[model samples]
Target: MIHKREFLRRNLPYDGRIKLASYYNSRHVRVPVKAAQITKAVRWHASLLQPVTGIDPAQLSARSLRAGGAMALLAGQCDTNTIKLLCRWHSDAMMRYLHQQSLPIFQRLSSKMFNNGSYTFLPEDWVPAAAE
Candidate 1:
């Protein structure tokens, strides 16, 4: 994935100005993308995810990327404040990401549950203490 990201960055045509996204249309015109363009790009790229993840491409939208990113941060055990800042979410809205956790979170909890010894104790009858 790191290599693919690097390759994409290297292969992409970069103008003198550094933009978040730059792409060439079939007409060979460079489109310097803005926020709205990124949404379109994300939706188009989501189609590519179907083949890689076997998910219904139609069901995935640009917003999925934000959710997935947030979930990734949650799985990483990043601080709640950091996640909120990174995600630009206000209030405790980011906590919703914890509601439907990813597999990594479940696996981590499961590992801890198994690795940590369980506590078991039987209570004995209480007896009066004698004066020392």
Candidate 2:
């Protein structure tokens, strides 16, 4: 999930020698990247995160970084509208990532709705279930 600026940076080391098309393939060759190779690259990146997160690499893809980054920005208190644009979402599609927040909101609302904080609607109504 290289952003536009980061994609440019990947070419910085090579300078003038390798132009726009250079990154299309691995270091040993100069052929255009194929789907299989790209998938391997994503898998490799996902694999590196497994040791730190205890998450299965098989469950992650390069898109995981984008989704994680969006959630991170939200957790950091960045504006939802800003995150939406940074993620290149033309619509409110980025709001989908904030789906985790929905649980907390629902719990809070349900708690108040069901007799002023005595929430029988959900067992763990006070605590956010998404964090678990």
Candidate 3:
């Protein structure tokens, strides 16, 4: 994402190039990231996490973890296309889960009434009286 943004910025023929580092340095006293450091940092963070007891960390790819996270979000009622784009999945399984979970909530809310038999409204209670 950052690379794409930077590529667009640099490729545009402006009087001055908007280098990402300069943009960051201008905004903050300490620059948080440089494009060159992104890969190493991503790999280092991925390496630092311990794998599940039965799973090997080396065998796990970031893409797979992202897809699993997207699935979990769908199961929890997140918008499917948004999660799909975030996870970069090609299938509609996430959308199906979201719709299935949401249908029950919609049905329950639709069946409920604003007032039951125990409540009644009188016209006097709502209308203002005229003075003679």
Which runs in model 2 stand beyond 4 Å of their true positions? Answer: 1-39, 48-52, 101-132
Candidate achieving the largest TM-score:
1
Model 1 segments beyond 4 Å from truth? Answer: 1-36, 103-107, 110-117, 120-132
What is the per-residue lDDT of model 3 for residues 65-114, given as tens digits with 9 covering 90 to 100? Answer: 45457667755666767788876668875554455446665565565654
RMSD of each: 9.0, 11.6, 13.7
Evaluated at residue 49, the lDDT of candidate 2 is: 81
Q: Given candidate 3, what's the lDDT at residue 26?
A: 44
Largest lDDT belongs to which candidate?
1
Tell me how candidate 1 scores on lDDT: 0.68
Clashing pairs in 2: none
lDDT of 1 at 115: 67
Instruction: Assess candidate 2 and give its TM-score to the true structure.
Output: 0.47
Task: Indicate whether candidate 2 or candidate 3 has the larger TM-score.
Answer: 2
Residue-level lDDT tens digits of model 1 in 1-132: 433444465696434454436666665555665656556776677677868877665565556677788888887788778988988898887666566766667777887876666744447756668989
Model 3 stretches with alpha carbons more than 4 Å out = 1-11, 14-47, 51-55, 85-88, 93-132
* Model 2 C-alpha lDDT per residue in residues 1-132, reported as the tens digit of each score: 223444465554433443443343334344644555656777787688878877776776656666778888877768878988888888887777678755665577676676774635466557556954
TM-score, cand. 3 vs. native: 0.31
Which model is ahead, 1 or 3, in terms of TM-score? 1
Clashes of each: 0, 0, 0
- In angstroms, give how far residue 121 of model 3 lies from its true place: 30
